[model samples]
Target chain A: MMKIFGKVAAIVAGSALVATAAFAEDRKSYPAPKDHPLSEIISGYEFRTPETRALQDDDFENPAYILLDLGAELWSTADGAAGKSCASCHGDAAESMKGIGASFPKWSKERNKAITVEQQINICREEQMQADTWKWTKDPNMLGMTIFVKNQSRGMPIVLDNSPEMETVRKLGEEVYYTRYGQLDMSCANCHEDYYGNYIRADMLSQGQINGFPTYRLKWNGVGSTHRRFKGCMKNIRANPFKPQGEEFTALEAYMMYRAVGLPIETPSVRN
Target chain B: MRFAALVLSGVFMASVASAEEIKKVEIVDGAVQASLTGKPGDAVAGAKVFKGRRAGNCLACHGNKDMSGEQFHGETGPIMDGVADRYSTEQLRAIVVNSKKVFGDHTLMPAFYEVDRLSRVAKKFEGKTVLSAQQVEDVVAYLLTLKE
Candidate 1:
């Protein structure tokens, strides 16, 4: 009887140690007030000229409408091995996908990781439509779809639902934002946080808030997603960017969503 | 535990290591007299470095009177007209090496050579300067030719 009791006690203690190890890997924490010093900065929208602001306000003048038009058509047209349109499964995106973009970069139980809206779209294409995925960084079709999805959530506040599972990734996103890289030796914070309203030559710098993404940038003269913009910034800093829709970008997206918590979703917005 | 030990060893190596292959420059009487090239700087190579996107990209900020035909010449900094009259060749070399030594540290122009003061530098460039010693001299040689 004494021998059996000793064995049971050892097993219980060993399992407890294993449980603690697993818990350490998923340590839950959000950015404290002291952690992110630039938490109170406003969105980049406030720094734009009146002419640019007017362009974003009117849907007809906005050039992103061209991509939106393409996306609307693609939503109903069948193009995959399944020969089924997105409308066939989801039905009238205006009705089903309204405010959906605001919640994305959400935790996906199937993949066991946080997936961005672009990644979710690709997963749906491969699994349900039996089609090829759009290259999240360069493809026009991908940008159109992303712009269209985000346009649906216009005027809605960004909310990630803040699941406990997403906490680890959200922290990692914050880490990526603050960690400095490149030959220029600049981090996202050095420009966006430390020198928010300063001028680097002719261009005025903003605080780098990403509330109005999927914006039509004058530099590109076309629609661009958040990940696409991230790539451009990496290049500008002379750092080789990671692939779009890759784990690093998804983590960055997760952090961006949390940062823009109170701001309205203004996708397909205009920017210089 | 082994991974942690390896990382610690790498950090230790990084701290004690000095720059190699990159020739060092000297500062004398508020000027940099050390030339990357042992001989006179070639004006031709210097011009290429000034305008090329891969390196100096000086024209992006400072307008050059010599390159008047070029499109989108910036008006941010003083035009490079008669720059030779403004500073001596050695002083110009000093400015390129570490501009903060002459201009205040707050200026937008980057220090082309000094390494220790920089932040968020890439891993491969831990203790290295941006322009090689020869490249800096070449840029200096090119700027010297901007006299009217």
Candidate 2:
């Protein structure tokens, strides 16, 4: 009846507003901190073709919105042993989850390790809601929830933990970055650091920043996590990829996030 | 006398098996003095290997001004044009086999033939090299054609 029609109208209007907001937001570039290894840090968006960048600029046109919308629905639907939905505790994600994205791969005192946003989501599910944790990479719900949460912090600059403890993790990440791996004998630095502006065959290499991760890749035709991208790169080099959310990748995430300090969160950003 | 014959036949079998194995070459002062395949390579066939994506894929990293016809030559490594004027045939052979031996472990160029030190290699590519001994020789010959 009239009430049902009104709810549908509100949902349509809300999505329209989000789409318009996405279109209105300008693409802003930030310079790296003075002590950064690279004189200037360039976003992967700059390396992409204008056509690909255009897809990210408009939410209505962005295919990732399909997942984001599903995430919004999941936020309110209660499905755990506790029968508590994310909204039951968080209540209005816009108000509760704002700026949370730019502050992740955070040091967890209880877990005694750095955990990414994806890990945090699982922790909340298991500990808070008594829900089964979703698979790290393959779960669409995990991807959708991650993107929806991170999208809340869009345009906020990444804030890193520069503590002594984080420094040790960052150093390990730096070592991993520099160490040559696999039959190809290529390090992360060999391509990303040394050849950022150059082409490897037809594909242009970028600085390999993770600021725009959980990114929508045209090559994948779907969204993928940063760790998934890392695994793919390791596989491409003919190396055995470390497991996602493992100690090595968490440390690597901490280091990469530090490298990308001051860059705006661009979750669900489109890339080729 | 029978044991001597057995040893000689074993040696013959090893030599025959080695035809498919990665060539053993010595690095002496940044040069390989011996040919890998004990035969000269075809430069024409080497050109295709240099350009082929499944082969050397050299154009992916090193830009060669001489190869203007090839699309999207990369600038990650040193330019390959005029490479003949920079090094001798023996030096080129060593570099082609294993650049790390000559340029040190920090070099971006991969050790195309060396596999012993490689770690965490994919299951399918384990114990395999980026190029064969003959392919390395072919690539070396092709590199020699790039004159100033």
In terms of TM-score, which candidate is strongest? 2
Classify candidate 2 by CAPRI docking class: acceptable
Assess every candidate by TM-score: 0.67, 0.86
Tens digits of per-residue lDDT for model 1, A85-150: 788899989888898788788898988999887887788888889988888766778878877887
Q: Model 1, stretches more than 4 Å misplaced?
A: A1-36, B1-21, B24-111, B114-129, B134-148
Q: Residue A138 CA error for candidate 1 (Å)?
A: 2.8
lDDT of 1 at A67: 86
lDDT of 1 by residue, B17-130 (tens): 324365666666548766766778877987866775546677765778787766555433446787786678888898788765665453345667767655555566656666
